[model samples]
Structure formats: C-alpha cells, structure tokens
Target: MGANEALRVAFRTFGCKLNQVETETLAARFEVAGASIVGPDDGADLVVFNTCTVTSKAEQKARREMRLALRRNPDAVAAVTGCYAELDPEALAAVAPRTVVLPGSRKDALGGMAEALVAARLEGLDLLDELRRLAAAASGGLPDPFSFVPGEARFRSRVQLKVQDGCDNRCAYCRVCLARGRSVSLDPDEALRRATSLAAAGVPEIVLTGVNLSQYRSGGVGFPGLLELLVRGVPSAAFRVSSYEPDRADAAFMGAFSLPGVRPHLHLSAQSGSDRVLRAMGRRYGRDDVLRAAEAARSVRDDPFLGADIIVGFPGESDDDFRDTVGLLELMRPAWVHAFTFSPRPGTRAFDMKPRVPERVAVERAAVVQAIADRGKLEFARSRIGKTLVAVVEDGGDEAVLGDARRVFATSAEYLKLEVRGVPAGFHGSCACRVIGLSDGDGSADLVSIFI
Candidate 1:
C-alpha cells in the first residue's frame, strides 16, 4: 500500500466487551490515518485480530480465524493483539505468513506503526518483516494499561466507555490477570468528560467496561462513584455496566441501580455457585454473596435482567458441589446464564490441579445449566407479555427482516431482545415498547414501539 492509497483494514474481535471497545478505538484511529475499515471477508490489505486467551478454545478459535482471514485475502498482512498475543506472541506470530504480534500492553502503538508502514509503501513479505521488527521493539516496555485514544467513529448504537484495565485478583483459573498485570483505572474526571462528549455527539447509550470493573478506583472515586458522576453529568444518555464481580456488588454498588438513566441489566462474574468450588478456585466470596447481589439488584430495579457467568466441572468439584451451584441458580433464576466448561489454561494454577473432571462430565453439567438458563429466559419473556418497557433500537429499517419477515430488532433496558414493529421508517433510538407476544422461531419477545 502506498501513502496515496488508503489501506483496507478488517478487524475480528474475540472475548470481552473491553476488547470490542479497544477494537473500535483502533478502527477509528485507522480510519483517521486514511484506511478503510472493511468486513473480515471483504478482501483487505491489512487484517487485525483482537484475540482472547481466557480458555484454550478461545486461543484455538483465534488461530483458526487468523488463518482463515489470511486465506480469504492471500496478500493481506495480519496484526494480532489482546490477551492471547500478550500471553503467547510467538504462537500467534507463527500462525500464518505475513503476520506480526502486538501484545495487549503495547496495543496503543499499533496504529502509529501501521500509519508509518502505509507511508513507507512497502508490500508483500517486506512490509510484514518491518512490522514484526517494530512490534519486537515496542514490546520492550510496559504501557499504561488505561491509556485513552480519542476517536469519533461510532460503530455501534451503544458506545463502550472503558474506565479501567487489568486486575488485582489472582483467581486460580484465570490467565487474563497474568497477561494484563495489576489494576489500573482511568481518571474519574477524564471518564466523565468522555461520557459527556459521547452523549453530546448524539450517542444514546454508553456501556462502562473493564477487565475487572469492580476493582475500579482512582482519586478516591470507586466504580459506583464514577457511575454517579457520569449519570449526573450526562442526563441525555443511558448507561450500562458490562460485567461485575460478585463480591464487589456491595451496598454502594447496588445503589447505582437507583440512579436515573442507568439501565436495569447486570452480568455478574459468578464463576461458580458452589462454596467449596469457589474456595478451591481462590474466589474470596461464597455463595451467599452472589445471592445478596441478586437480591440487591431486584430490590432496586424493576424486573432487572440479571445475568451471570458460571463454570462447570472445575478441579476437585464433587456432586454435592455441583448441586450447590444449581440450587443457587434456581434461587436467582437469572435471565441469562453463561455456562462454560472449565478449560484449564496454561500458566494458571488450575492447569496442573489433580483429579481433573472428565470432559464428558463437564459437557453434561454445562447442558444441565444451559437448560435451566433457557427456561429462565422463557419465563422472564412470558412475564413481560403485556408490559410496556423502554428499549433501544439496535437494528431496524423499512427493509429490516427477522427470519424471513420484516421487523425491527431492539434491546430493552432489562436486556431483553425485542422484535418491534409499527414505528417510523428508520427508527433507531430509545422508545417505549409494548410486548405483544413471543416469536415461535427464536422466542424473542415480539413488540410494537415508536421512536420517542
């Protein structure tokens, strides 16, 4: 690619909402530096893979996608980054030809290097070699994990405002903490400023995200305090928390739900509900903590959509331990349960633990959890059959279709998927939706709404 020619860049992101936010930020920078952001299969000159290494499967998927992207565009150069690259750069670097690995810590500099590469007008293997050399040099030092790079590219309806990075906890099964290092938070003032700016720019909603959102602290401001600041500062925009840890869902944290404009949806990082399993996993909180968090959220918000992440078949987990997890789920009845089979990652404490759970057993437990989750979702959807709720239009137009029919897809404040109809020609904002019925195909609540 020459300086005069705009580089066609495609991005494939994996893992948390934090990674998605970072990918959007990178795409904005590339667009500013005279590059066209294209789809993964659109045949681009450069492709960026924002990978995840939370589990072996995530890393495997990253590798597979990287090779597929390269195959789709035979002459494309690849730029890999995120937790996977941070933990195993060499593995990603060797995945395919004409690829360079940029670790998570030094991700902010990737755009600058790409700009320089574009200006250099080098192509083929030469460009990839130079990018690799630059990545090696940039990997020498640690970076400010909470570094902010401003951009105006609003790719999605809800903008993700990342206020924190890294983690302080040493959860036995997690490899992300090792890759991201210690906790680092963005300044509260800066966070507020960014939120206000996004709201002013006509962005309807902003999602606060971080690797460990509950661990956020800066200048005597905690996550709840920062949340209050943004809610008060930007009255025009809605706010959502990406995910939070169960132990940190204290009184103060729950109080944020009472604030105006705060969305009534919460996804907790409740790895397991079994006290014994939680203890073995090095989690500080017990099963009661998760219950209390759920209770607190319900007490504050009106039928809030409570979601959680639960790991099945962890090291040394017994039948009783698994029962405890299911019992907790029965009590909470979370709208969404992200049931995951424990994949022991290398470099984590759980990797070498003895008496490993059989893969077949793990899969069975996951299926059980998933069944309960699906039932909970259906029950929740049924309960809202005749209620009117606030929803944000995610995808809709005159020609928008849902499974062969025309419909507008929206997400309610309680995080329910709504297929709405009978609105304006191109409705795309927050509105009051009346749940009419449920769709037979996907079970998404059918609704009717108009732009507010």
Candidate 2:
C-alpha cells in the first residue's frame, strides 16, 4: 500500500440503520482519500467493522466479525469501531490483537487515519502495531460525533439520513446513553441540503435514523420540524423514521404523516409493559402512555406499521410483570415486537439490582414474547393483501422475469418486505403495486402491478 497505489477497503456494519449510514459516510471519506470500497467477501488491504453492544449477542457478533475479517484477509489491516468499541474498547482490542480499535469517541478522526495507515504499510513499518499504539495514545472522553452525510447516490432507492446522535435517557438496563452521550441533532439547513442532494441524485426513499431519533433538537427545531423541512425540500423522496421511546411520539410528531412523503411506520420502544418494571428500569413512560401514543399515531395515519422493542427479563421483574408485558402487546396489536432478553451490562444501574431473573427463565420469557411477535408479523403482512402500496425495488436479484411475473424484491412505504411481480426492470424508479398475497418465506409479501 502506497500513496501512488490505490488501497482497497471493506466495511462490515452490525447495528442500527445509523451505523449503516455511518459506514457509508466512512466509505465515502475513504473514496475521497483515493481508496476503493469493496465488499467484505472480497480480498482487501484494509477492513473495518462497525460493531454493536446493545446485547451480549450483538457484542459476540461484533467480536466474531472482527475475527472473521482477520481470517478472511490475514494481511488486511482490521479496524473496529462503533458502540462496542465505545462501550468496551478493551474487549474489542483483545478480540483481534494487533488490530486498530477506534472507539466511538475518536470516530471523527478516523477519516484522516486511512491514509496514515497506508503510508505506514508502505514505509515497511508494522501497520497494525502502529495503528493500535495510535489508538491507545488517543484517549479521554469523545466529543459529540461529527456530522456524517451519506453519499447522495449511495443506493438505488433507500438512503439512510442520520439526523441525530446520542441519547439523554439513562434507562437502568441501557449502556447506550453512557456510551453515546447527550442528544444532539443535525442542523435543519444542512439536513435539508443533504435531502435535496439525495433527491436530485434520484433516491426514492430516505430513512431518518439515530440513537434517539425522536429526541432530535437543533437550532430550536426538533425531529418533527426537521422532517417537515426534508419533506418540503425533497418532494421526490419518501421518508421513514427508525425507533425511539414511545413517549417521544405524539400527535405533533405523527401529524407529519399529512405529508405523503412521510411513511407510516413507527419503530417505538416499549421496554416493558409492567409499570413497576418500567419504574424500576427508569423508563419515563408507563404502559398506558405507550397505548395512548399508539392511538394518537393511528389517529394521524389510518393504520401505520407500528413495531416495538420489548425487553423481557429485567431485574426484580415478577411473573405478573412479565404477564403485563404480554398482555399489553396483545392489546396494542403492534405490527411486530423486537424481543430482547435482559443482558446486565457492567456500570449500568440495573447491573447491581436485586432479584435478577435466571438466564434460563429470561430465555423462556423472551420466547413467549417472540411467539406473539411472530403472529403479529403474519397478521400485518396479511393486511397488505388486496391493497395498493407504493414501494421501491431493491437490486438483490437479476433483471429477469420468471414465467409471467418478475420477482422483484421491494419494500413498502411502511417498511414491509415485498416481492413485487409484473413490474418491468426498466421501471427502476418507485412504483405502485397491489399486494397479491404473502410468500411462504418469512417476512415475504407478494405484489403485482395494479395497472395492465
């Protein structure tokens, strides 16, 4: 690797849509530095894995990806960053010894390090050793994350627009707030500029994502205000927002649906339905609050795709508490639930809380919630049948028709997976299709062209 010779860099992201968008931002920066971004499957001179640590399983996956990157390309300079690095830098550093570990605190400086690493390799210096030393030398609390702008023409349809970063809520079971810091939103003007650029580049959809998406606040404009600006500035793009606490949602926020560009989907987090458990977990809202938010959202949009995150086994939770959670899900009838078994992270308030649920018990409780979730997903998918949905096609399949149908993969405005047929390949732009039925495959929806 030398200044004259272009370097190949590959990225593997494992977390939220925000992480994915950040990876794209990093890739764009690498390209600006004269590096070619390649897939992880391909051999590359350097690889980066943006990791997650919301759960033990997520951390395990991040460590595994770091190790796999090294195994796939033994000579590759591997770097790990994101939540896992921010939460547990030592663990990630120990995972792939000699690899560069950049904590979320130092992520902004990463763009400048790409060329430095390449230059070191060319100088016959040990790149990994030098990078790891540099990682250690850069210490102290990280400032607010640098504003990242995803490439204008990054995807065919959906482009994730990160309008916010960090969180303020210190929920007992969450380490994200400690790792991510206070909420800081993107500037509305800069956000609108990015949105307009994406629309001009032919992006059909833009997914607004962040650690605390609904908590976005910058220049006296909140998430809803920012959304209105994006919608008005980019008429060509449809927008979908990722998850936030249920109480963060209200009529004012959901009312943005009046704009056709704002998609009808709310990935809300209702950690636990039991008021006692919620109180213990330091959650700001109760079960009823979640229900009201859902109702208010529905009032704005007839039937939006409502999904939630439900943590099952927090400390001091009794059977009645667990039952209350399940009951609430049954009553709310959300489109789906992201069921996560409690993983006690060190330094979190809940870590030392008494009467911790046994691991086996927590696993069983998670299964119960997931069963309800599975049924909810099926019912939601079935609802799409016989209705026309405006959707954008993804390019996972070749442009060829099978029989009388073209099995084009797509996603509806509400973030539902769709297998669209009868739409021409040349029709690469967004299109309206009538959902014919559900595929046997999980999360699969079948759609046909509405027009002859």
Q: Which candidate is the best by lDDT?
A: 1
lDDT of 2 at 72: 82
List the candidates' TM-scores in order: 0.94, 0.92
Q: What is the lDDT of residue 41 in candidate 2?
A: 67
lDDT of 1 by residue, 344-433 (tens): 999989999978999999999999999999889888888888788788777545473443334677888888888777656555677787
lDDT of 2 at 402: 56
Q: Write the per-residue lDDT of candidate 2 for residues 1-452, one digit (tens) a residue.
A: 44345677899888777788888888888877667788876877778888887778889988887788788888888788888888788888787665777887677667656666666655667767767766766655355464577782255577888888888888899887887788888888988888888888888988888888878999999888888888888888898878867887876687675578899888778988899999999999999989987887788787888899999889988999999999999988888788889998888999899898998999999999999988887898888889888888875654567544466778888778777767664666587878777786644453333422
TM-score of 2: 0.92
Tell me the lDDT of model 2 at 445: 51
Clashes of 2: 0
Cα-based lDDT at residue 260, candidate 2: 80
Q: How many backbone clashes does every candidate have?
A: 0, 0
Runs with alpha carbons beyond 4 Å of true place in candidate 1 = 1-4, 121-126, 148-151, 395-406, 443-452
